[model samples]
Structures are given as C-alpha cells and as structure tokens.
Target: MTPPTPAIVTQSAVRPLPRWALLLLCIAYVVPGFVGRDPWKSADVTAFGYMLELAQQRTPWLAPLLGGMAPETEGLLPYWLGAWAIQITPSWLLSPEMAVRVPFAALLVITLMATWYGVYYLARSPGAQPVAFAFGGEANPPDYARAIADGALLALIACLGLAQLSHEVTSYLVQLSCTALLFFAVAAMPHRTVAPAIALVVGMLGLTLAGAPALATLLGVGSVVLVVLAPGSSTDRRLPWTLALAAITVVAALVAWKLDLWRWRIVGANSGGKEWQSLARLLLWFGWPAWPLALWTLWRWRKQIFSRQGHRHLLLPLWFSAVSIAATLTTQPADRALLLGLPALAALAAFALPTLRRSVGALIDWFTLLFFTVSALAIWVIWIAMQTGVPAKPAANVAKLAPGFVPQFSALALVVALAATAGWCVLVWWRASRDRAPIWKSLVLPAGGAALGWVLLMTLWLPLLDYARSYGPQVRAVQAVLGADPGCVQTVGLSRAQVAALQYHGNLTLERAGLQDECNWLVADMESWPASERMVNAARWERMAVVPRPTDKNDHLLVFRRAAR
Candidate 1:
C-alpha cells in the first residue's frame, strides 16, 4: 500500500452509511414517544396500569383487574413482565406509564431485528443480490447493492407504526412481534424435516400467546403450502404431509385448551362473535394512505404468485395478513387489527421500492415529508387557537383543522430533513443514471429515503407528539391536593379513563367506595357523583376542593374530604 495502492484496492474503498441517513432512521424509530401521550385513556393501558400496581406489590404471578374492574381476563404474561420491569427499575426512573411500556419497546426492537433477518432471506431467495448486481452485459452486480438493500430493510423497521406501538403498551404489539418472528423462522427453513418441525413448535407458541389460534392455524397451513409448492425434487413432497399432521395435532390441542378455558367466563372476557362489517372497516382504516402502494405492488407481481422464487416467502405474509384480518374483523376492537397487516405491508412495501422510478420515488418521499410537515404545523396552530382565547367552536375548529393538528417547528424539521435527504437521493440517482448504472441507483434512493424518514419520525415527530399528550400537569394537580398516603384516597364512580390517567401519571390507586364510611377522601366527576340519598346516613363527607377542568368541564376533578374523620 505504501509503494502504491493497487487499482483494485483503490476502487474498493469502503463507503459508510451517511451520517444524516442514520440519524433520520434512528429518529423515526424512536420519535413516536415525542408525539404519543402516555397510555392514559386506553382500555389496554388501564389494564396494564392495574397489573403494574399488582406487580409493584410483588404479586408478579397474578393477573391484575381487567379494565381496572373486571377480574376474569386471561393472559397475565404482559402484566408479569411489566411487574418485573417495575421491580428492577429504580422508582424515580419508572413512571407507571413507562413501566408498562418498557416491554413494548423491547418487543419492538426484537421485531425490527426479525424483520431485517426475514427480508435478508427473502432478498437472497429472489436472487435480489444477483439481479441488483448484474451489469448491462456479463459484468457482476455491485456488492454495495446488497448492503444497501439490507440497510433499507432496517430503515423500514424503524417506521411510524413502530414508534406509535412502542409508546402504547398493548398485547397487539407483542402479538405483532411474535408474528414477525414466526414468519421469519418459517421462511428461513429450507429443509422438509426442519421446516415443519420448527413451524409446529413456533406456531403453537405464537398462537397460544397471541390469543388467536385460528390465525395460527392459517399460518401453519400456509407453511405447508409453501413446502408443497417449493420447487425441489421428490423429497419436498413428503415434507408437506409431515408438517400437516404435526400442525393438525398442535392446533387440535390448542382448540381444546381454548374451549375449556373459555367455558367458565368472567367479566371482560372475549366471547367470539361475527362482525364482518367491522372487520372490513378495520381493514380499510389500517390500510389507508399506504394501501394503494401495497396493492399496486401485489398486482404487478401477481404473475410471480406461483413462481418458485415468489412462493418461497409468500405463504407466511399472506397467511398472516389474511388470518389477522379475519380474526380482528370478528373481534370487538379494530385498532388491534392494524398490527396484523404490518408485516405484510412492510414486506410488500419493500418489494415495491425497487420498482419505483426516480421521479415516482421522489414524489412518494415528498408526499410523506409534506404529510408530516403539515401535521406538525397543524398541531401548533390548534395550540395557538386554544391559547389565544378563541371561542370553542367545535364545528369551525373541525373545519379549520380538517385532517388534524401538526407538530411545531421541531416537528416540521423532520420533514425538512427528509426533503433534503430526498434531494440528495435524486442527485445520487442522476449520477448513477449518467454512469449507465441504474440498478445501483435503485438502492440509493430507497436507502436514503428510509434513513431520512426514520430520523424525522424518531427525533422531531416523537418528541413533539409526546409533549402534546403528556399529563404531567394533571398529575401534579392531583398530588398537590392529596397527600402521598395510598390509604387516604378513593375514587367514586370514576371512569376507566380517569382511573388509568391517575394511575399512570399520578401514581394513585383507586378503590371503589363500597360504603360511604370506607373512604377518607373521594375523587369523583361532579356530573356522576351519587345522589345524597345513596350515602350511608351516619358518615359525613363534604366537597373540600375542586380542580377546574383544564380542557373541558365534563372532566372537572371534585375532591371530597371526610367531614366525620
């Protein structure tokens, strides 16, 4: 090297991922925390809050109250984990909100890793490396293309949904992660013997934990299909039968267990039902804004459906998407349904990336940038309107901020940064095209866009969102009024929403007032306070304080201290 660097050595100099690209992707993955308010009002959040309280008391094995009232719900796994996190983390370091969410964040990270691995395998199977590397003639495709694709996949994992899910603790998040892992495992299994065996074990575990076996059954069937459809010789034929038998046995066992478990019903327990319309609506909501691209990609690749390369990675995503949609449609809540499509959409979106032209790609990039930028600005505008003593005209306000609020300047910065990165990407593509190396250019735009999107979301978008949703002031108000003693306070006719907010932000425990004499203090909504006739005659309670509603009168906090005590 000292004598004179060889031509090959000079040409092979390593190129690192651009600093700005890395920063953007990291921001996107982590930034949801910024915009997302804590899990204050959500039913799942309330359930976890109760669980965390139980765990804080060292009752890690027990399921906490469902919906902060019902005791009959199953699946104490998330609760146990939350409890464990609470126990290990320092008291000051953990808010009840943060305690429950730690698991979500950890699982999200795992999902990202699984996604990378899955995409790597999928890319390899499709001869993505070979196709990407192939020059105009007999020359080999550049090695950098493979590295770039891998990086782009990683960037996709650090998406907007990941941030939102990680901020809100929910079983759906866990199920999504498990689902991704299951598919990854299935897709990676090449051999007949290993594939079914692995699918059986992983499939069982995932279905059991996900609280959805029908979907798991679909996944198992799809895996078998993949095996049958695989292009190998006679050996592949025997694989499907073996896998089918094993899957049947496992699924049958799971169904039996589920039936027996559901026989004795408690409050808040899910009773299976049919809701086809809701399912359709859920699917529509989940697919919005991004569904068009996903659908386009699938349509274009329809011919590849039966091809050997296409079938290899197809079954898992298809089964997962189909079953998840079906199951969510049948269930009561639709939000959870969004999670089922994440893996499929992400993978499908990745496939579409390679096909987009430079102009088209730039348009998509700009659209996302503009979407976030406008969103951020809208939030600030709303805040300004609210602050400047604007009359509360719900209809007018709705008309004005039709779509919704946007983040502040800090939030808008994410969009600006993305636009800049996209500009750079166009330049890179232009350079590559000039050199007659368009294939290499494919990797550049996607990689740059993904990286930029990630950064914008994580750093600017998340922080702004979190700040907007935080209930720190509300927590402070409660604490100032009520002393720190857990035994002194009680909540009366409190909604689960209020209970969750108090539990998460204020570290307050709420107990139902069985008798008027049971409580020293009562926190209740003025509108819903029980009639005086319902009070026990001997015990006296008087309203001592009222915290005026910050945002709405319906939310005023009326505090009653014992007149007798």
Candidate 2:
C-alpha cells in the first residue's frame, strides 16, 4: 500500500514567485565574474593553459599538455569544450578569456535549469505532495510543485559554496551540470515526456566524458533501482524505463573504460584524521541552509522516506548526495567533488517547505533578512572606504592583503550594484509586511541577498581579487628579469600557475630542463636551487637574475643562463 502523504501544506501556500523576478535573479547571478576577470591561479589557470594549447594547435587533441606537463588525467572533456569555444569564437567580438567562458557559463545555466525541472518533477510525486483540505480548498498538485521548485532554485543560488566555484572556468562545473541532468532524468521518469529519456542518455554519457565515470556509474545504477522499486509508481507497474536507464549507464561505463577515460586520484588522496575533520567541516558549511533543511526533511519524513512510496521522492537525492560525499572524501580537493551534490541538496531542502511550522518559517525569515542585509551593508561600506578612504581601516586591510591595488570607480558597475540592492530592499519589504505569502517566501531574501553581495564583490572588489588571484604581477616580474631577446626557457619544478603565466602573459615557450632537453635558461624557485642544479649541467649554466614579485617576498624566480652552450 502507498504511504500516507507526509506534507501538510494548503492552497494559499502554493503561490508562485514572479517569472520575471526569477529570471532577473539568475541573470544577476550568472553574468558577474564572467566579464573582466583573468583566469585565477591553481586549477583554473592550469585548465585554461591546456585549453589555449588545444585551441592554438600547440597540443594534440587526444593528449593535452601545459608547460610540457601532461594534461589533467581526470578531466579531458572540459578542456576540449573550452578549446572548441575559443577556436570558434571571433577574436574581434570577445577576448580569448571571455570567449572560453561563454560555454562554461552556459553549463552553469544548464545546471540551474536541470535543478528547477528536477524538483518540479519530484515534487509532483504522490508521496511528495501536500495533503488535501477537508473543506475542498487544498493546493493544486502542479501549483504546489512549481512553488517548491522555486524554493529549490533559490536555495541553490543562496548556497555559499556555489558562489565562487560556479562562476569559475573549471571542469567541476561540467560535472555539476551533468549531475543535475541526471537528477532531472530520474525525477521525471514516471512522467510521459521524452525529456527524461533524453536526459538519462545525455546525463550518463556527459558524466563519463567529464571524467567522473565512477560517479556516473553509481548514480546511474542507483537511479534505475530508485525508479523500479518506487511503490505505486505508475511507470514501474506498466513500463520499465528503469531497465533502459540501467542499459544506458552500462554503455556509458563501458565506453569510459574502453577509451581509458577513468582517472585514479583516490589512491594517494585518502583522508586522514585531520583531513576527515576538515571534510566534516566542509560538509557542514558548504551547502549551508540547504543541509539544515535536508536534515529536517529526513527527520520529518523518516518513516515514509525509506518506505517504497517516499523512496521515490527522497532516495534519488539521497543517493546523489551519498555518491558526491563519497567522491568528496576520496578526491584530493573535496570542493569540486562536493559541487556535484548541491542540486540534490537543494531538491531535498524543497521537501522540507511543507513540513515547516510557522514559527520555524518566521525564524528562517528573520535570520536570512538580518544575515544578508548585514552582508550587503558591509560590502557597500567596504567599497565606499576603498574609494573614498573615509573609514581607512578596510582600505588599510585591502592594501595589506593586496598591496599596490588601486581601486577604480566604474559608473556602470556601481549602477548595477545599486539596482540589485534596491531589489533586495523591495523583496524584504514585501516579505515583512505581507501576511499571506508562498511556502518559498522564507528563501527569497536569502537568494536575492546572496546575488546582491556577489554583484557588489564582482563590481567593487574585482580589481583587488584579480591582484591577489591572478599571476600577472609575478608574470611581469619574470619578464622584467628576462630583458630582451631571452631564449627558450627550460623549467625546473615550476608550478602549473607559473608555467601558465609564462606561456600566456610572457608568450614564452617552456620545456622541462633535463639532460636530454637542450635549452639556454632555467626558471624555478630559488629555494629549490639544489634540485634545479640536478636537472641541468650546472657547470655550463651561470646565475642570471632573481626576479621578485613586489607584494610577496617569498615569490621570486631564479633565472639561469647556459654558459655559452
């Protein structure tokens, strides 16, 4: 027998957020950090380096390399996508940086779209729906689903973890997109639409191509089981798309293995005692508001959740979250692995909306209002201090952190920030005074506030962030030391960020310095002088110059010239 409905929502609570408002929020969230930002250090720069190589035909398509180092074994598809975007984009219309971002930006949008649709389908399930009123004034199932979907989307946007990573030009975003697509496919399995089947195929294949074959396999298998075992499932009784889903995943897994696409980062990246503690901390805060409500959803619906009927609604997201957490624990940097689960967390959070007591909802509203309002105020104050030197403290802190950062005023940016702030105010006022609002009302402010803060940062603090994160400052230092007509440089233990900077900013070709490789100059950190000596014929090369990044004393490059080789 089907479990009784766990939701206790009413018709009045199913009010839909305005379409225009939702559209504007998404535009505001996705557009920033895309324009006017250089590729940041570490993984972002390293990935861009490979993409540039592929686009310029400097590296073969099958194998990508950055500064002569092998391409990332875990992610080849993201590089290919970015490279193709760069090659196809017209140089006159957009810069190489901006051109590459076009597709990654779309991937983030795809992620959001999948999430909205995923929750829409899941919330439509019989077990997921709210109770019918005795007086015959209950919510329409479809309308209730739409309202919950809106809340899920807002929760996703408000997530602190998604702020920086979603905007980044990285493979992680591609994984996240596919994860959401898988969610959409699984959630919509019972519906009579071609969308779910197509999503199933694309989602499975996309995850494999994106260098997450293991997760793809797990999610695909779990989804099939989730569909087939769902009690009272209309699809389970008459049709068996679950088997089709299983078949699709099997093909995806085989294709990945056949192509040798699966990578092994878990071998040496296992978590230790401290690392486990750190992972726990990451899990607690990464998804923030979503995690708390997700826990609430599990507790409130614990009995129904494991039951056949409720499993349809709860387990799909739970499986996704479980696999993502597993991936997070196993991966070297957990953030990227953790990104794949945000959509699932948001979906689970959406279920908690109906069960929320009035007091609980009020508390959520008050906390979100205070938190975001304060954050927006701080961002505005910092921008003012940086621009006018009124308070002097925040400006001093900026100088201390990002020395030599000269803050500039942009009228357009300021206008955008002011508009978003105004929007937040209107949303707040509407929430506070209005008595009868939708179930999703509590989250509206938090989402808008998060977007407002992001806009402020991208506008007012972009320069300072670029100063700290970009390798331009050090790249300039390296070039200054090289003087004119510097020969090809052989690198000894140069990090990916440094290598990418030398290739992009300095337009210098780099190779590994070894007995087999012949080059005139060597570049590496001075601290590694002894190691650098081992790579080249030290007797034949003399010290050339030491170039130091002005802001960071430890960041200096030791250059060596071949002794008339």
On lDDT, the leading prediction is 2
Candidate 1 differs from the real structure by a C-alpha RMSD in angstroms, to one decimal, of 8.8
Query: Which candidate has the top score in TM-score?
Result: 2
- TM-score computed on alpha carbons, candidate 2: 0.94
Q: Write the per-residue lDDT of candidate 2 for residues 1-565, one digit (tens) a residue.
A: 6556678877888989989999999999999988888888777888888889999998888778787787564567888998999999999998877888999999999999999999998888877877777788778989999999999999999888998998877878888898898899888877756888788888888888888898899898888778767755675442568678878989998989887887767834435688778889999889988889999989988888767454677888888988888888878678888989999999889889888888988898899888888988888888898899978998788778777777888888888888988888888888888564588987787788888889888987787778788888777767777777677888877877788888888888788888666677778777776564557767877887787665677877888887884
Q: Can you give the TM-score per candidate against the true fold?
A: 0.70, 0.94
Off by over 4 Å in 2: 234-240, 267-273, 515-520, 532-534, 542-545, 548-555, 562-565
Native-vs-model 1 lDDT? 0.52
Error of 1 at 350 (Å): 2.2
Q: For each candidate, C-alpha RMSD in Å?
A: 8.8, 2.2
Q: Would you give me the overall lDDT of model 2?
A: 0.83
User: Candidate 1, after superposition: displacement of residue 41 in Å?
Assistant: 3.2
Q: Give per-residue CA lDDT, model 1, range 1-565, as digits (tens).
A: 1111101211122133455754455444544442334553345556566566676573335435523464323444455666677777787976655666667677776566566556545545433322222333322223333333344354344244444554556556656776776666665555334643554465456544535554555566666666565543256554655465456647645764764422221123235544555455656645543345456546655556544443554445556666665655454455565675676655655555445555765565456545544554444354444444244563355335332333344446546555655564564555445442332233344444434544544444443334334444455677777777746466766666566677667766566554644667778767666535454222466877776434343566777777854
Lowest summed lDDT window (length 10), candidate 1: 1-10
